[model samples]
Each structure stands twice: as structure tokens, then as C-alpha cells.
Target chain A: MNLHHAPSSTPLVEMVDIEKHFGGIRAVNGVTLDLYPGEVVGVLGHNGAGKSCLMRILSGAMIPSKGQVRINGQDAQIHSPHDARDLGIETIYQTLALADHLDAPSNLFLGRELKTRFGSLDDGRMMREAVDVLKRLNPNFKNLSDPVSSLSGGQRQVIAIARAIYFDVKILIMDEPTAALGPSETAMVSKLIKQLRDDGIGILLVSHDMHDVFELCDRVVVMNKGKNVGSHRIEDVTKDDVLSLIIKGQLPDDWVPRSQETVQ
Target chain B: MAETDRSPPLVGWNLKLSASSFHKLSALFTLACLIIVFSFGNPAFFSINNGLTVLLQTAVIGLLGIGMTLVIITGGIDLSVGSVLALSGTVTGLCVKAGIPVAPSMAIGVCVGAACGLFNGFVITKMRITPFVATLGMMLIARGVALQLTGAAPISRLGEAFGVLGNGSLFRIIEKGANGFPKVVFPGIPYPVILLAIVAVAAAYLLNRRQIGRHIYATGSNEEAARLSGVAVDRTKMIAYTLSGALAGLSGNVLMSRLITAQPNEGVMYELDAIAAAVIGGASLMGGIGNISGTMIGAFIIGVLRNGLNMAGVSAFIQQILIGFIVILAVYIDQIRNRR
Candidate 1:
């Protein structure tokens, strides 16, 4: 298998020959990917296609059995989520994993709460930062004080994104962010993803939504049956190519397809 | 524009008022109801002396309840507090018998209590033992140790200075007698009562204003989330247990000083009383929501119920039964309010 290298760009994060196994089952085998600065890479796969597993390894939620992870050309030893955070890697899980009882500011500051002179939580500062971050991500988000439980799915996603961005995350891993959202919410998330890319954050987004991949992601990496099948630029590949990779586990060798559909 | 019109203000003045008032008013409502019931039932219930007696009696349990409130808010229970108290009192007795100074003996008692708390914390956090189970085991062990230390009997003959903690008044005043009657008035501030107040105030400040206090709530509310957020979950849990144990020890020592004896059987049912006080004060058994003030009120409620029952000629067994019912009722009320 020939590997293409984008040598002009210095990748923000690179995983070389990554291998992870759960007991006897090989979850991810010999997968290598690079996320460049200001790029959103879509990881497309079916259920149990090792997409989540690979992302988990990247986020340091789980350790890879073999292979090395390098951040900005430095070897990274990420054994836990805290270690991931130290490296500016943050993950927003499908469950969102947010504390429902806490309001936005509290959730944003969770374990690393800002403290006042008296050593209590600096609520005013946290609130101010939360507001500023939310406005930059989505100006329509106005209810910053309400408990996340009371917010709509879209609002919760916005808060989650805001949390990662405010922490100055260099690599953001989002798992099925729009899985439970409506069309309008999906659009809002798409817009947020674009904004995050513009801020030069490297994002690894795992999703089943082909439309989201085509619309928001600069490049798409297709995974099938626990292996990296191929990576394609959005400009060079069509939706049919991605779907074929996901279904047949490989791109067609010689299929000429029509091009230049109107850009929506 | 349509969406903005539909959405309510993030936080309205009325909504904030209602939320704060809801908790304050519920506590007020319960207090008012308790007063009205006791006043109507017994004419002597509201007497100054009777009130002072109730406060003195509630002080020890109130101190334990404050600690329990913190522990329970962190989603932990300390069933061993009663046993820890007995052990602490026993240690104080042994110290005095061995000719240790009264003040130092008292300090040793408190240190013993803190040791018990540290042990409980270690077992729960490092060993990953459930708080209830670990404390239950510690409770049995502490009780057995107390019994063994005292030879399963009462140890009397405490130092005079120690008695001042339980029985002696801080101040005394002479008043004029009416119609050739002689009257002597002692301020009637028991040392335990004073200590209880100090501890309660300090606990309230710690729980409500300090970063450690916030960590306790965060740990109790959602432990995994707390850890992810960088709140040391194990350390917070350890602090709660240690505080609970130390206070229990203090309560035991005070009880012994008041009675002028270390009775092995004295603290047998004290844990129930402390737990009831915490629950009655609105500290949820599920944790992450409680305060020292609420716990003090709960201790008073228990004290009043016991005092009122005695005045009304209720048997001791019946008083226990009534208290059990009240605890269930208070917890039920808390559950309903939380659901809303």
C-alpha cells in the first residue's frame, strides 16, 4: 500500500502505525493519520469500525497497544485524560459527559475552577469567560446561566465546544457531535466546526453523517473493519467514493465519475 | 428574532427570588410548625430554662450532625461515629487515670477522634470500600475497643477540671431576691454547647465559602465528573470521613466529661440521633446538599421531641418509635421537595 505525504504542511498531531487490541479482538490495526493545523479531518466508519477506539487512543482515554503518538513533532506519553489535557487534547464524547446539575459556567470550569482571593470559586470570572467564548462560537446562545440539563441539544453542544476552545485546546476530538441533533442544530454545529478550524485548532471528528463530512471537513479518512482504508481530499473525492470505501472496504480501482456539482 | 422572543430571560429577578426563598421558606415553615405544635402541647415547653436545657442536650449531637452533614453531602455515611465517640471518651478516661493533665487529656481525646477519621478515610479511599460498609465495620471495632479498654464497665472519678467541660458554668451572677427570697443565677452556658456553636460556625464557613467545601459537593454530586474536572475525589472523601470521625470523638469526650464517667454503653444509639439530626436539617442521604445550620436545627428538633415526650409522660420506648417516624417523615419531605 502506497502512503501519500502532505510534506508542505507541518502536522499538529501524527499517529504512526497505531495498533490497539481489546483482549483477543484487534480493534484498530496499523492505523496512521495526521491532523494539520487549521484542518478538520472527518473519520468515517460504520458501527464498531474502530473510529471511536482510534479517537479514544488519541484523547488518551485508552492507551494504544503499539505505535507512537507525536504532538507537534514531540513524542507524547498520554496515559490518562488529565495527561491528554496537559497536551491540549480535549474530547467531547457522544454522551457529552457533562455534569447535568451544574450550570454552564460551573461545567466549563469543572475540576479546574478559577479561585477568588478568598479561595472560593471565582464565579464572576468564569461567567465572563463563558459568555465571551459562547458569543465567539455562537452569538445566538444567550442563556449562559441555566443548568445544561435545561438547554437544548444544540446549546449543550455549543457549551461543550466552548469549553474545549476556551481551554486553548490544540487538538479537539468530537464523537458523533450531531448524532442527536436536528437539522438546524446540525447546521449550528457545522458553523462552530468551521470557526474552530479558522482558529487553527486541529480537529478529528468521527461521524456517520456523509453530508457533514462533505460540507465541513477539509479531508475525510475512511476506516473499515479495523484498518485505515484510504484518505481523500474533499475536492478530489465524491460522496460515492466515501460510501464505497465504507461499504466495500476499498475505493474502486477504475471508476470514472461525473464531477463539478454546484457548490452549495 | 422569533426564537429570541420565545426564550425567557436567562435569569429573571422573580425566578432568583423564588429559588432562594423556596429553601429558606421550607426550613422556616418546618420550624414554625414545630414551635406551634410544641407550644400548644405543653405550657412549660417554651420556658427559658427548658429551652436552655434543650440547647445543652442538643449540643453534642449537633456537633456530630454537622460533621455527618459534610460527609453525607460528599455521598458518604459514618455509622462508626458512635463507636468512635466511645473510644475517644475511653481514651480520655485512661489518660486521666494515668495522671495526664486535664487539658492535655482533652487534646488526646480529640486527636484520637481525628485518628479514627483518618483511618476511615484511608479505608474508604485507598481500599475503595463503600463508606457505609467501612464505617459499619469500624463502628463495631470501635465499640469493641471501647468496651475492652473500660473492661466493659463504667470508669468514674474524672478530674475536677474535666467536669467544667460538662457541668460547670462559664459565668455566675447573683440577683436580688423578691419578697425575702434568695436567688442565685448561673449563666448556664455549658462548655460543650459553646464548642458546638464554634464548630458549627466554622463548618458552615468551610462548607459554603472554601474551595475544599466546593470540592466536597462536586465529589458527591458526580465523582467521575469531578475527577475529570481536576477535583481530587479521593482526597475530598477522605476529608469528609476524617471530619466526621474527629467530631464524633469530641462528642464522646464531652459526654464522658458531663457524666463524669466513661460508660461503655453511653454512645450505643448516638449515631442514630446524629444521622436523624442531619437528615431533619435537610441534608439529603444521597449527599451533595447539606449545611451546618440545617443540621443544628435538626439536632434541636430531636432534642425538642425528646424533651416534649418526657414532659408529656411518654415512655422511653415510645419516644424512640416517635423519633423513627419523624425521621422518615422529614426524609420524605426532602425527597418531595427535591423532585420539584
Candidate 2:
């Protein structure tokens, strides 16, 4: 992880003390996290660890039981995915959230489609734009008219990523982006994440891959049993230390604790 | 590169047809085969009069199929269409009896259907009822309402202007043959047939060229994904169901005009025919796979088959069984095509 540049500006996003409950089960306890501009923060957790729930709250898929989100130091009311999208927050869900029957251009501009002066769908223009963005991510992508269900997993992943960055996105929430990808595809995604971060976009990367966290993320946050275990700069903690945090929600005995507010 | 290797080579018309397009066209191919076979079975089946008769016969069901195609493509089934058609006709009949003008009365009838569809949409989306159960309930309710409204009576002898909507033709040309026998040059086209053509073209335009159409497909393809993607899934479904209702109402008007009467018990089992046409045209009950042109052709197939069978003196019961078998065959072929 690169540590040369400091966060000199207001953090791009501040999710403060978010809590969510499903009936008697607490899916996410009070947890707070901050992301600065041009940084990738890896959220590490096992299944049902509440990391996905926390990210979903920020993505506006679920309303937190108690908490608020601030974008650029301003509170935002994210009640639906539409609200999040308007705030330049995009999420690539673990399922990719793609309608399988539609073609590339249709999926790329699913809800927010471009229209001609006659108020009809501007399919030609959309096709061109989809192709351009898709080629940027994977140059070899071709079958532009085929239904997305016919595409390979890697290609579908590219479509999901393309959808997230196709517009003027300020923040991106990726839930297990590389969980289903192979070795070469994983490398491609890592490169894309770095590229987007370099473009000044704040990214919350939810993953279980320690190598991915160690290599790509500037900071790491771990959760266990719906509670935040710890937050650390990737350079300050070893992979095993982060793994222990994910599994047992513990920190090293000799490690000095940074104040919660100043950790970022 | 590996992905490219998995897909067929993107060269030639074969690739352009794809699996879905082929499935849609299969219906057209079947229609052609049926026409050829029927023409051979009965020479009169190949005449211009028979062709016109088939189009006239198809008008009501074609309109119903247009709406059915839209609803089915949205992954919904509207079982109340036949009942709604009867209801629309009876309502229009009551309006005519009350001395309402022809055009406004027709519009009111279509609107009534639209309102019922809107209510269905509201119940399914807001009240969280499955479309199947909701529409089945609507079927019973609409039929009962239609029967009760007219007291199980038939409204007959509507005005001359109303009769023109279903029976009138344009550009008729007849010449006196030898021995003073009248030979028909052209029968022109029935108003209902023309109406079906216009509605079908408009429907095709909406499905292929509009944003709402894409949203409808997306909603049917995957509702959760559409919601997450910012599609107003409920609104799309409402539009689909509403359109279905309006089209069914319009079909009712045409039917009433043709019979010169509106019977409370009319249009029983018509919904099944509409569904059959849509399915035979390539619309899947599972949703997100259908087209207007395919549906219209599918309607014509039914019309032609019935006319040809009648000319051959086949029993009505046998024709019914044949149509049911054809519907199953069409869906089976589509499934096989898609599985490839």
C-alpha cells in the first residue's frame, strides 16, 4: 500500500455509528467508518459478519436502524438506491445486480437511459457509449447485442464495473467484486481499482481475500458478529493480524491503540 | 480470448438470428406451413375472400393478443381479459341505452378496462399479491360484475354508426360478370382489421423504441435487480397491466360491433385464446421474451387454421383440441430453441 500522500481534504464519505436490526437479530451494530478521496478501504469479514450489511446501508439498499451518512461533511438522506445514485454513490452488488435478459447497452443504462429529441430510447448512442466503456475495461469484449446471461462471469463483472463508473461517480461500494473471479480477472480488477482511486474516487471494497486487502487497500477495517473489530493502516498490520481480527475480533497484545476518531 | 472461443463465430446471418430471434420466427414458419397444408386440403381456403375472412376473424383476438403479449413479457398473466372484454361491452351497451354518443361511449368502455387494470396493479404491487392469484380473482369478479350489470340479458340493435366499426369496409370494387353475375374485385378491408393493424404497429413501436419498454423487460427479467438499478418496477408493471386492460376493452368494442349486440355471457374462455396467441407468437409466460409482430402472426395462424378446418367440415371440438395441441407445440419448440 502506498502511504506517501496524506488526506489534506475533507473525507469523501462519513458513515457514522450505523446500526441495523432484523427482528431480534442485530445484523449490524453501531459502527462508524470514514473514507477519504482517492483511497481504497478494504472491509474484511466472514459470512454474516455485518460488513455487507454496513456497506448496504451506505449503498442505500437498507435503512439503518440508527445512524446517518455524511458525504463531503454534509448529511445525506439515502432512503433508496435512487437517492444514493443521485448523490454519485454507486454499488456493484455481489450478484452484480444485472437484468440477465437485456443486452449490453440496455444493462449499462438500465434505469437512467439516454433519450432522443423525440423521447424515444437513444439505443444507438447508448450502444456506442457502452462499447467504449466496456472496451476501456476489457478491450477484447465484443458481443454487444447478446443478452448478459450469455456472457462469461468476467465479462459480466466488467459490465457491473462499467455501470458503476459510467457516470460521474464520487464513491463506489463493491461487495465481493473478486470473490468469483479467477487469477487473471482478479489482477484486472485490482488494476481497475487502483485506476479509479487514482481518479479521485473513494471506494469501499468488501472482500475476504487477505492478499487483495494487503496489496490494494491503503487502510483495512474488519468486522465480526455485526461489530467493528478494528481499523488499521495496511502498512502497520500483517496479513495474519488482520486475519485474527476477522476471525477472533482481536488485536495484537503489544500494539498501541490509536484514538477511534483519529484512526483514519 | 477464452470467452470469445466459447461463443459461436460472429459472422453470417446465423449469428444475427440468435436463439431468441429464431424462436420468434419459428411461429411464422409454422404459420406458412399451415397455410400451405390448408390450401392443399381445400382449394377455397386459398381464395382472397378466405384471406379477408381470416383477417376479420383475427381482429378481436389479435387485439387481445397484443395486450397479452405485453403483460406476458412482463412475467404476468391477466386471466380476466375475457371477462373484462364482456364487461367493457356491457358497459358500452348501457351507455348506448342511456343515449350516449357512439365515440364517447366506446372511449368510456376502454377507460373502464384501464381502471380495472390499474386496480389490479395496485393490489399486486402495494398489497403484495402474486399476479396469478390476483388476476384469477379479477377473472371471477369481472365476470360476475358483467353478468349482474346486464341481468344476464343481451343488449342488441345498436345504432348504424356503431355497426360500421366492425362490419364496414373501404375501397370496395365490384364488377358485373357475364350473365349479370356480380364478381367481387376487392372486398377492401374491415374496420376492425384496420384497427388491429394500427394498434399492433403502435404497440410494436412502444416495445422496441421506448425507455418504458426496456424497463418493463428489465422488471420482468429480474425485479430485484431492476429495483436496485432505479427502475420503478411497480410503475412499469402498472403500465403493462393497464395497457392490457385497455386493449382488451377495445377488442370488446369490436366484438360488440360485429355481433350488433353485447351479451353478458359473451367472451367466455376468450382469455385462453388470447394467451394461446401470445404464447404461439413467442411470448413466454416466464417473461422478457416476446414481440408484437410474432403475436400478430400467431393470431393469423389461429384464424387461418379455424377457417380452413371449418371449410373442410372438421368438427368444432376437434378444432379446439388441435389449437390446444398447437399452443403446447409452439411453447415446446421455443423451449427447445432456447435450451440450445
Best by DockQ: 2
Candidate 1: tens digits of C-alpha lDDT, residues A179-206: 9888877887888789889989999999
* Full-model lDDT for every candidate: 0.80, 0.86
Clashes by residue pair, model 2: none
lDDT per residue (tens digit) for residues B1-340 in model 1: 0011112353545554322234434665777677678888899888777877887889889988988888998888989888899999889988998899888897898888888888999999999999889999999989998899889998888767777788765555657788666566756666788888899988877875567876787777677766655577888888888999889888988889999888877788788899999887777677656667778878888888788888888899999998899889877777676577
Model 2: how far residue B289 lies from native, Å: 0.9
Summarize candidate 2's per-residue lDDT along A1-264 as a digit string, tens digits: 223356467878888988999999998988888888898999988899999889888888889999889999999999988899999999999999998888888899999999999999887788889989999999999888788998999999999999999988999999889988989889999999999999999999998778888789989988999888887887777777888888889876755434333576
List the lowest-lDDT window of 10 residues for candidate 2 chain B.
B1-10
Question: Residues B171-265, candidate 2, lDDT per residue (tens digit)?
Answer: 77889999799887999888998999999989887887788888888888888899999999999999999998898889998999888798778
- If you score just chain A, what TM-score does every candidate get? 0.89, 0.93
Question: Which prediction has the highest TM-score against the true structure?
Answer: 2
Q: What's the C-alpha lDDT at position B301 in model 2?
A: 86
Off by over 4 Å in 1: A1-9, A17-31, A63-67, A135-147, A223-227, A244-249, A252-264, B1-24, B168-188
